[model samples]
Target: MAPNFSDLVEEARLSLQALVDYGDQLFNPTVRLGVTGLSRAGKTVFITALIHGLLRGGRFPVFEAFATGRIARARLAPQPDDAVPRFAYESHVRTLVEERQWPHSTVDISELRLVIDYQRPNGADRTLTLDIVDYPGEWLLDLPLLAKSYQEWSAESLKLSRQGPRLPLAAAWHAHLATLDPRGRADEQETLTAAGLFTDYLRACRDERFAMSLLPPGRFLMPGGLAGSPALTFAPLDVPADGSAPDGSLWAMMARRYEAYKDVVVRPFFRDHFARLDRQIVLVDALAAFNAGPEALHDLQAALAGILDCFRVGRRTFFASLLRPRIDRILFAATKADHLHHASHDRLEAILKRMVDRAVTQAAFAGAEVDVVALAAVRATREVRMRRGHEQLPSIVGTPLAGEVANGEAFDGSTEVATFPGDLPTQPDGLFSVPADSGSFKGLSHFKGLSHGSADQADYRFLRFRPPQLDNDGGDTPYLPHIRLDRALQFLIGDRLT
Candidate 1:
């Protein structure tokens, strides 16, 4: 389709902004790095740990610029955007280091700036400004809505909700949807009820057991300050995909609100924040999907594909920078590597690589540097070996969060235990295949007593662990332990530092 007037106008405005930004960059080199992931993907922890490691000089052997003494100093700087909230790095660090508790998840968009003074290989000193833009990945899923009309989106959403695990979760919403007539007069209360039920359905899909990831209209799940606003109080109705709504009908009302949501919520975010990113890192809690089963993994794969489609990815040149900025480097990190033993980390990375293969291929073809790594931003567990009937079993030792239960034992927050974290399938392909009779949901139950290649269903027992205890010696900043975080750093911004 040809670009609409609004689309052309948006491109023009983006070009103007890029020109201004490029002019500023001539005097001060900066990289706008966007950090995002779906709910509970450890985005908050990842950002906090990355900044803390740089500022406090945590060990990062793989990050060559930092490890080789090329980085002279790193410090927090005032973020450029005054309107966005500054990420609470101090409080988050305190929560992890002092209290030994994981910080809260990201609920809104925030930004932080890190200024690193480094020496080039030739001994020339240079300063690089890093602007980390943190936001919910759910917002990225909404970008596709820009090209979808209200009728088309409604039809697709309704059809998707009727399938797989979503079928049962969306029962209430579906029941309500059945009675609503698209041609009927617009009624506010009815619309409110439909919206509420729809939101509840989305919430249920995100449950630990299901771990479904393809839920869209992202604002519905994380409304933030937009709660109760008309822009957010609309739901997908049973309407004809190719038909036009009559004036003042319920369908028309819904179509108007849907358009308003795109205009007021999604478009502004794209125009103001997303379009300006020079680099991006998408965090993924693939372990959660492993525990949830194959359906969840499939949904996650689809969600990832949608996310890649939204990125303005391409090779950035001098002329391109002044006209339209493109995200040239993207790192997809499978988070929570500490949940698994070291032996399985490579297998986990392989699984994620397989999941993102198609999307990464497309992004790479478009000139973006794409790579996948399995990492724990903040290592919560340490590797250990446990004797199980004379056989040595590779295990991990960590304090499970209060109320976390495993093998019929509930752990208190203070008690440490060693658990045999299960092995991942060496061949990642087995994880993607679905058994014919496993049914649509095929949650944890379906995997029971079944072996998918070398790994059985029981090989993915991932429990939530509390942050590691930091030794505070005379108030000196303690080093945070991480698995493969340096590798992630190298892929994300190593070239820029050099």
Candidate 2:
């Protein structure tokens, strides 16, 4: 007799507990953080940096205070292969350190766990477990379409085909669908032709790499299965005018299938896996949009609109917030801030915040709390001095790799400087407070113009980002990273921390 799926799930769940149980309870809270981003956003770097921070026991200066605050202790422990399995942080670290190269971007869903022992404010020793999971950004768009059907999907896709360069391919598929007799006995040959056409349309979408807000997983459209099978066959029809209009129009059949896809595929995954998440970090690549031309910007907006819609849980005013089980706090972070000079880091965050603010507001109106943070997952450069006509500013200097060049262009952020240079100044609190020696920081100036990568190679540049500054009420801070971590813990998992 074979083991039932439930039994297997139970065993896996039990195995995960051992891994989850490694941290000290009072100081460390069991928290789950979701890492998500658009196709080329630096989620990998963010995750890698986070793992490095934890592994080094918060030795990294970036998170030094956070490691000590509310967290009296921190450590790395063995993780289990249960659940989705831990993220291969060590493997990524080796790639970055041993090979002196950045880790390749993620292609599929992956998971990693970091167990930290900490001391909470109340003087209790506790263990905090951070479970990080990553998935392809492309797959995220499909969440909305889980509610859509084959016919609906097909019709919508068909419409997309008419616009841009996608029209000819879609027209061919539409012509094929037009020939097939929907009312006639389902002819395998006709169905096969339609599926083939559908597959072609999907392929075209993939090839164009259009930032579509919704797409069924590519695998589903081009399944390695029998042709004309029920899985590949979809009938997308429109909603009828009459309430009782059940006469199987292509729309009705498609609608039914769409609902089935949701019930069978999307809903189960959310209910079983995603809903359990406690924290989420959404990574955005704003630079990509500014460079992709107007269409890409529109696509970015559309994608943001779609992503925000997911957290819009309920309809009612009072009861809805209480009833909707959201992942609590969502962090919308601009990834790869490392690529730009420090001077423009806030501007990048502001740009992203401006771009997604409306959608975020709408999501909040529907009942989810969201905040934006600017982050660089990997640190690629060091602060440098720049001077221009007696004005100096804090800037980063590094020998950028050849591949870091964008759009077949090469511009260096380096400069020849005199022997005596002033020490790096503190980050400005408010916008536009020029340091007294802005004139001396000549080598630290940022580029004024925007640069973008072409379609062929995305995620090629090393992103340098400005880290978020914490508001201190003039207290002597012994540990910086621990304080940030504690604040984050308080906001995200404090209730569970104690």
Query: Quick one: best TM-score, which candidate?
Result: 1
The TM-score, computed over Cα atoms with residue i paired to residue i, of candidate 2 is 0.65
Best by lDDT: 1
Considering summed lDDT, which 10 consecutive residues are worst modelled in model 1? 448-457
How many residue pairs clash in all the candidates, one count each? 0, 61
Write the residue-wise lDDT of candidate 1 on 106-208 in tens digits: 8899999999999999999999999999999999999999999999999999988987778999999999999999899999999999999999999999998
TM-score of each: 0.95, 0.65
Global lDDT of each candidate: 0.88, 0.52
lDDT of candidate 2 vs native?
Answer: 0.52
Q: Model 2, 186: alpha-carbon shift in Å?
A: 3.2
Summarize candidate 2's per-residue lDDT along 186-214 as a digit string, tens digits.
Answer: 34555556656666775655442443323
**Worst lDDT window (10 residues) for model 2?**
416-425
Clashing residue pairs for model 1: none
